[model samples]
Target chain A: MSDLKNNLPVLYSYFRSSCAWRVRLALTFKKVDYEQRYIDLIKNEHKSEEYLKIQPFGLVPAFIDNKSGQTLIESVSILEYLDETYSDFPLLPEDPLERAKVRALVQAIAMDIQPVTNLRILRYVGDDRKDEWARHFLAEGFTALEAMLQKTAKKFAYGDSLTMADIVLVPQIFNGVRFGLDLNAYPIASRLYQELNEIPEFKATHPTKQADCPEELR
Target chain B: MSDLKNNLPVLYSYFRSSCAWRVRLALTFKKVDYEQRYIDLIKNEHKSEEYLKIQPFGLVPAFIDNKSGQTLIESVSILEYLDETYSDFPLLPEDPLERAKVRALVQAIAMDIQPVTNLRILRYVGDDRKDEWARHFLAEGFTALEAMLQKTAKKFAYGDSLTMADIVLVPQIFNGVRFGLDLNAYPIASRLYQELNEIPEFKATHPTKQADCPEELR
Candidate 1:
């Protein structure tokens, strides 16, 4: 049912997967020409045994390079690899300390926030309590994020340059609105989100802009 | 109740904090002589306003570098900073692809595995069926980790070297045992866990060996 059998540098992605959206931003920013394979999470396409072969975690946005035939999973790792291999729009800062700061910001959302507030946990909480659970975790995470962003943000998440932290921030802010999170509470992050969305790469790779986002959502 | 004030490369750690343990392993491997400041999660020390200044997320394993006076939160970020700052016992591989692979593995555990089965989620699920909840999430995470390790692992989590992936695995595996999850289900991870634990660096930085571990538990 899918043409996943390919040799070209392929991205196994889903339209609404914020994790997948992060990859799309990196690939687009670096100006790398690559093929996109939409894995419909709504249809449970990502959980198939075949898909699991590509991403053992059975998550969207698994990447495979045509050059080395390397299958890279995990958004941060994939972003790092593309940045290293492309060398065009370097996602990481030059200084190790700055790079570490950017990475810490990246993981603060990726590890702490996203995982706690994701759909899997939501379903576990059940529909009656999902919104409460989502908002609680999102606000909790954003509280910390707001404080960190205050210290870290200059023009973007880490200085004037749009590092990996900014790429990660876009979708998280979008999700905050979706979960009915008050953007006013995280003033710095909301400002940075607006600034980041001005860039074509960020806008183009947005959840609603994706091909598989469905007609109504678009 | 604690000597929580210091600035000599201090680590906010706990006896059984796996997140903090990752930092300990990195510091030990790099042979960095740093001061340890235990934040007792059980005593709600990490949740205090003063501690929140050190770590906005109110979590343990926050590190402040002596030289740069940079306070780094999140275990992976701190681990990475230590790796980059100290040249000894490099935690990441030289090759970009290999490093990405290692990082992906690190996050596979750090983001996916650990966050899902941590104390936060366990408390959310409550004690009535916490074991079942933990085992389910842990097994799912480990299943993917096991499959990924089978391919990437030679002796350790990523080849023969003790990379960050291995550092992450040791604690997760310990958690697997604690949750009463049968290690036999994941052959590769268990064997690699054994091989990794044999190292002095791994043994020395273990959760049980830390100073704040309660006497009876030790």
Candidate 2:
């Protein structure tokens, strides 16, 4: 275990969680160096006594700022905290109206889409039904997201320059691809995903590229 | 249809949606009057051509401010917008750190719990497995929430004053009770839920109290 006295931010993450990926992208974009502790969700290590103290929810991507002695859960909250504390690359717009717009778009994906297709929720559907459930929900959410993107796309979800929305969209699209959902129906989203996937922050944090990602997924 | 030219704030809502209920509570708390337009989720009214123009996602509680012509979806965003624009009872704290704590608590309930138990996701789980899935997921979420509440509760989720966290919590706990989950395990949550339920803003906006809640649910 890394010494808490070092005062660096530590992220407890799994290799493949979209929620975890959001923070990884944000930290990389801001150029913050922090230690990483991997929690193997497949092995249920997240729920063990040691990990549970850090994250009561047994969710990955709990960020610990040893400097402030602050531990934050919820991916979006962590993203905002990092942006506010670091103040390097402004992840959210300065104007409150624009901030609300960015937040609404991010929440659209975070609250609406991610929870429905998360690994734990999929497991509840049983193995035989998991893929079907994943495909069905992803399609339902993507249809709406595609419509929003088609109407709102102006370089990114709101305008030029990456915001919290882009951070959320890329990983979700990655998951959509993993689930074999057709992207032809969502041209704007597909284009944005293609563009964002090539960005250094996103590419560096890609699940397959993560230092901890297993060889098979890589 | 309310005239877009008029400066009225319009709320597109399904009477029983907890999300819509949250906005209603805020509007009432802020003493902001809005014309309530019912979108019958049960009858697929939200998916109708007319409603689709207003809300591409066909989700309940889409808020449109005719004055500014600013439209917003997502309950938390709407709550924050109202808090920012009106500046009445502050839904969030002024201090950035305090605001982060409130937001994190709200997101814990909104992103982590509510989406997983929403009607659309439940329907996707199919009737055969909906109850089991709902029960299991809600129980898991509440177990963690209960622990969080135990640590944070001081008359409210954060302290003596009510915040957005309370607004999100009441509806979720109401749903938890409706699903027959025992609240006895969560005294902190139970105490606060009982306390918040007594407030006029929350009481007036109770799901059963809504004009459109079905007879069966009532």
Candidate 3:
């Protein structure tokens, strides 16, 4: 990794991490130039004392905006920060009501679905139960999410414009597929995921396409 | 339950639910006059088709803004809507960095800590292991949160005036205590929870103090 200058925002991320992927997509979507510093979760680099100083929670995707001297940890907050700071391509709609709808979809995945099956939780519960636990939670949450998507989806998760909802949705769908979930079970979500996967922002920041991705995955 | 007119934004909530409690506190804090319609999670009322139409996620704390004709699910989104629509006694800080910081703390608890130990997840993992799982995740997450609170707290999770961090912190601390975790282990969080508990807003919105609270708990 190259040493970051005071002018560039550095993102500490792991290629396979869903949380980190959300921020990467946001940065790319907003057309913000950032330095990507890999934190190898497989080797437990995120839990290091030095990294913990950057993110007290010992999680991936901590971002440092050197120009403004702002450091943000959570993916949701980091994405919001990028959207607010860049302002060229707004991730959230201008109307407060529309913004709330987009945010609801983001939290539905970020808060409700993904966290329960996070790597740390899986490790704590034991390796033997990981796949079963993940599949069950992902499917159960997606059942509701599918129903939600049916009501709210247009060209994207919200409407024609790509919003924060679509940004969060893509990585979570990636998680679902990685966990062996049959996307066909949730047809609405499946279709949206397939369509959104073709977008340039989603394509560029995909886990498999990342600079630090494993050779086999890349 | 009173009939909600086209004028009031009715909150679909269950008093015992930590997610619902956050919205309740936010509504009370904002001094928004709204109707409360109980959805008994214990009775599986949230899973009913009628209720599912309102919130496809089958989660409590769905808010319907009759005035705006918007129905929003997810506590964080609802809280943001309340902040934006009401614009009095703002839950989030105006400065983007401070708002991002406050949001990070909210996601720490809402996304990282709370989701792993939600009632649905607890039931899925088996009742025998519920307390063990809840305590383990809560303590681990709080260790990090304690460090965060140490760095950021004063009279509340952020500073003197209450912000989104305190709004999220209180209910999560409530969940921790409910699960039998000793708050004393994290002195900073314990102090804030203790102090915040003494305020009228927190007191009035306490789970046991709610209209839907069971008789014994009440």
Candidate 4:
């Protein structure tokens, strides 16, 4: 890894991490020129004392903005920061209530779905039951999310615009499919995933297309 | 339960739910005059079709704003909406990076800790080992949160003033103590919790002080 400079904005990310992928999408969509510093989760680089000093939480996808002189942890915070700092492409809506809708959808995945079914919890669920557990929580979360989308989704997760909801939704869908969930079970979410995956921003930023994805997987 | 009129803002909450409690705090701290419409998770009321229509996610702490005519789900969204719409005592900071820091601290509990140790996941962990599972994840999340708080907290979870970080943190600390994790382990968080609990707002809105808390628990 290159030494993180004070001038360039940095994203400490792992290629396949859903949390990190959200940051990548935000940067790409906003057309921000930021450097990437991969924290290999498979190698337990996030747990190292060196990484801990930077992000007390030892999580993947920590963002450092030279302009702000702040190293931000948590994907939601990074996403919000990027949207606020780079106003060229806004990820949230203008109306306060509309913005609230967008954020609710984002948290459907962030707060409700991701934490319960994350890699850490799966490890505790044990190797044998991991897939089963992931599939169950993903499906349950999707069931509710699907119902929500029915009322809100127009062309994207919230109307025709691509907001933070879509940013968070797609990668979570990626994880669901990886855990053997049939996307058709939640058709609205599945449709949005299809529509979002077709966007140009997704091509360069897909997990398989990242620098660190294994050759066989790519 | 009173009829949820369009004229009054109503919070769909169960007093004891940590997520709901956060919403209650935001509403109280903002000094917004809102009514509570209880959806008892203990009775599986949240899972019913009637409640699901209002909050498709079947989660506690859904909010409806009279002015916007919008029903908002997710505590974070509601908290943000209350802050934005009311604009009296702001829960978020003005500077973008500072706001990100407050939000990151909010998610340290909301996304990382709450989802893993919440009532829903504890049920999955089974009756025999619920406290054990809750304690383990609480300690791990608190350890990381404690480190971060040392850098940020002064009087509250963020510096001196009450922000969304404190709103999210105190309810979570309430849950942590309920599960038998000693608060002293995370001194910074504990100190803030101590200061926050003694405030008059908390006294009126604590879980034990709420309308629906049963007599024995109260």
Among the numbered candidates, top DockQ falls to 4
Alpha-carbon runs more than 4 Å astray in model 2: B1-6, B214-218
Sliding window of 10 residues with minimal summed lDDT for model 2 chain A: A1-10
Fnat values, candidates in order = 0.87, 0.64, 0.91, 0.91
Looking at model 4, residue A78 earns an lDDT score of 85
CAPRI class of candidate 2: medium
Which candidate model has the greater TM-score, 1 or 2? 1
For residue A189, give model 1's deviation from the true position in Å: 1.2
Q: Can you write out model 1's per-residue Cα lDDT over B1-218, one digit (the tens) per residue? A: 13324545788898778898888888888888788888898888989999999889898779878877778898998887888889999999999999999999999999898987887777777788789988888888889988898889997789888899988888878876898677889999888878778889888888888888888887
Compared with the true structure, what per-residue lDDT tens digits does model 3 show for residues A80-116?
Answer: 8788778888999998898898899999999999898
Q: Write the per-residue lDDT of candidate 3 for residues B149-192, one digit (tens) a residue.
A: 77788887987789888888888888778886788899898888
* TM-score (2 decimals) of chain A in model 4: 0.95
Show pairs that collide, candidate 3: none
What lDDT score belongs to each candidate, Candidate 1 first? 0.85, 0.83, 0.86, 0.88
Using lDDT as the yardstick, the better of models 3 and 4 is 4
Quote the B-chain TM-score, candidate 2. Answer: 0.93
Which whole-number lDDT from 0 to 100 does residue B9 have in model 1? 79
User: What lDDT score goes with residue B163 in model 3?
Assistant: 86
Pick the winner on DockQ between candidates 1 and 4.
Answer: 4
Q: Write the per-residue lDDT of candidate 1 for residues A1-218, one digit (tens) a residue.
A: 13335445788888888898898899899887678889987788878999999898888789887767778899988998888889998988989889889998999999989887876667677788789878887888999999899899999899989899999988877876787678888899989988889888988888999888899998
Point to the candidate with the largest lDDT: 4
Candidate 3 chain A weakest ten by summed lDDT: A1-10
Q: Is candidate 1 or candidate 3 better by DockQ?
A: 3
- Residues B1-218, candidate 2, lDDT per residue (tens digit)? 25753567888888768899889989899998887888888899988998877667788889887646777888888887788788889888776666677778888899989999988888777788788878888889888887777666798898778888998898888877776667887788888988899999998889887778888877
Candidate 1 docking class: high
